[model samples]
Target: MFKLNEMAVKPVMIADAGFMYAAKMSGQASHYDLFTPDAGELAFLADEIAPHPFYTRGFMLHTDNKVTDLVQRAYEHENAAQYLLVKGSTDYIMNQTGLLFSVDRPSVESMEAIGGTGDTLTGIVTALISTGMNIPAAAYAAAKINRIAGLYANPTPATQVIEIINQIPRAVEKVLKEDHGGSF
Candidate 1:
């Protein structure tokens, strides 16, 4: 539906929320490079029979403990992109083959209650991909960066997403210096 082949440059396609739903519904999910789906959304993608997220089977919803199963199901049904960044208590970075990595350390529990944290993650991954980083690496880095930003924010239930976002620069600096020998 996107007519990606007609584009002069085939840009890396990353989808989340509504865009991700469109990709899955269009049966063009394979055309995308990455999908950032939270656990509940992953259920929607995994339910091949469901026309939309709201219709996903009750049994399949919010099964965070079975994320690997959901990932496998989504891929088997061709409802996922080439790569997936499953965001939750533990962020899972995966490719079509299987799970590649997981990031759970430096976890900021209060970040979960804060709105837009996931959106921030999608933005970070998009920026990393735009810089020409491969999808999987970008996803992994973005997960780490997001968590670091949240840690820097020291968020509370009262904290706003803008507070976490404000720490992004410091987070980026810390991640690059620590993970990439200060050269990224």
Candidate 2:
């Protein structure tokens, strides 16, 4: 269990594509403080993007499949996250001002087939927030750290989620070394 103290300034949110879908379906999608969705889920949010009075879906597979466009649309409408993290071949981090960052390196394509990876990302972001990191920065770091863990795990189609879990500390270490001059 977690406790909130009066000094706590960071707002923690943990949600994925499924929850976003259900919320949108129930007309409460915009109520979330944050959302972490993949490329396909970004498309789902674009269903109601501009020039339309009603919502639509599956347009992600259509000509509107561009991830950036979809993310922009979602941020504009759908009452989406004040900070949005879209996971995919290239992870995108966005806030109301516009795209904050995009992390695409140390890529492991097989990570897509691995289950619980997205959940791992949520955990990483939450932990960062608990330390009082702002949502957008936490999310940006989370995306890169999660991918670095996958690379450290050297994932294969047969690789299980545990391998990725085991490499998280090392991944964080690597990111810290690169970003903090090996002090962490």
Candidate 3:
């Protein structure tokens, strides 16, 4: 979905908290499924509305937990771009850039507040998409790419978003040339 939309225009991250919870309970990883909504993410959504007053649209959710519906509704308004929720979330939309990446991972039980694993997954997606591979391939290559990125970002720092993006192009080239060659 994300990749298909990319063919048309840039995409807004529609995060459905309730839906996310369902996915989580159904065995989906919280990070890849439903991570916290952030400021940057909200800003991206706000930008989606050309004339402002951003109306609620599609939202694919996956989480073992969620906030309130009021919180979600509150985001439907002008200046919503500044809203924290829109700024920090994602979905399987094929917005302008197409399905950039979709990554899932395990969530820590009992512990809340920090979703480092989610961050790592998002980074993995970014790297895969930036590599110029197709959406399916990018999604498929996430685990291996993530493992390589993990080595570069270890210990104290842990999650390195840029590191993932930076390594993507080279990673894609290596994989394509070695495995498929002219097959594709």
Candidate 4:
């Protein structure tokens, strides 16, 4: 598909979280424009750096420098992404140049516990990118929007994904207002 779109006016690819597995297998991860991965998925990418499988969620959770090390290693790997959004307590946005920025706020732990939240983030980023935002900015803004939406919805163990999703407009509005300094 990438080859097919070589002539596209604005060639952009939005990789879903699972694309990491396929890219790892096909050795084509870095070919895409963007990739979204949670900590576990980030670990999976980092595991490719070593001959032995040493990355695990438990270790990532316990180690302070694990994410930084893993991201650096993964960014240098054969299939490293052009733009990567490592989703966790904080979302680390990176490129081949190295860590660009991270977005963490309205820390709703329930957002992590909920399924499809990452998919929602991908959707938000895709929309932003379609609007002419660069991959890095879109990912960063999408992370903030997703979290702000979660906060607006008051996410809890019982909260449904739709509830959080519904708050996206409010979140985007809030961000726009903040960016414009209280003006629309």
How do the candidates rank by lDDT, highest first? 1, 4, 2, 3
lDDT of 1 by residue, 63-180 (tens): 4549899999999999999999999999999878899999998878999999999999999999988988778878988999999999999999899999999999898788877877
lDDT (10s digit) by residue, model 2, range 1-184: 0343243653454568677777656655565667888766667776664222134554555764677777777766664666788888888888667788899997899999999998899888878777777787778778889999999899998899999999999987778678657432
Give the winner by TM-score: 1
lDDT tens readout by residue for model 4, 33-149: 888888767777766643322434455445575667877877667656788888889888888777898887878998888888998898999888898877887887888899999
Q: Of the pair 2 and 4, which is ahead by TM-score?
A: 4
Q: What ranges in model 2 sit over 4 Å off?
A: 1-11, 49-56, 181-184
Give me the runs in candidate 4 sitting further than 4 Å from their true place: 8-10, 49-65, 180-184
Give the per-residue lDDT of model 3 (tens digit) for 5-40. 456654322223333333223433222312323332
Backbone atom clashes (below 3 Å) for every candidate: 0, 0, 29, 0
lDDT of 2: 0.75
For residue 86, give model 4's deviation from the true position in Å.
Answer: 0.8
- lDDT of predicted model 4: 0.77
After superposing candidate 3, which stretches have Cα over 4 Å from the reference? 1-19, 22-117, 123-135, 154-170, 182-184
Q: Note the Cα lDDT for every prediction shown.
A: 0.91, 0.75, 0.35, 0.77
Q: Which candidate order results from sorting by TM-score in descending order?
A: 1, 4, 2, 3
lDDT, residue 24, model 3: 29
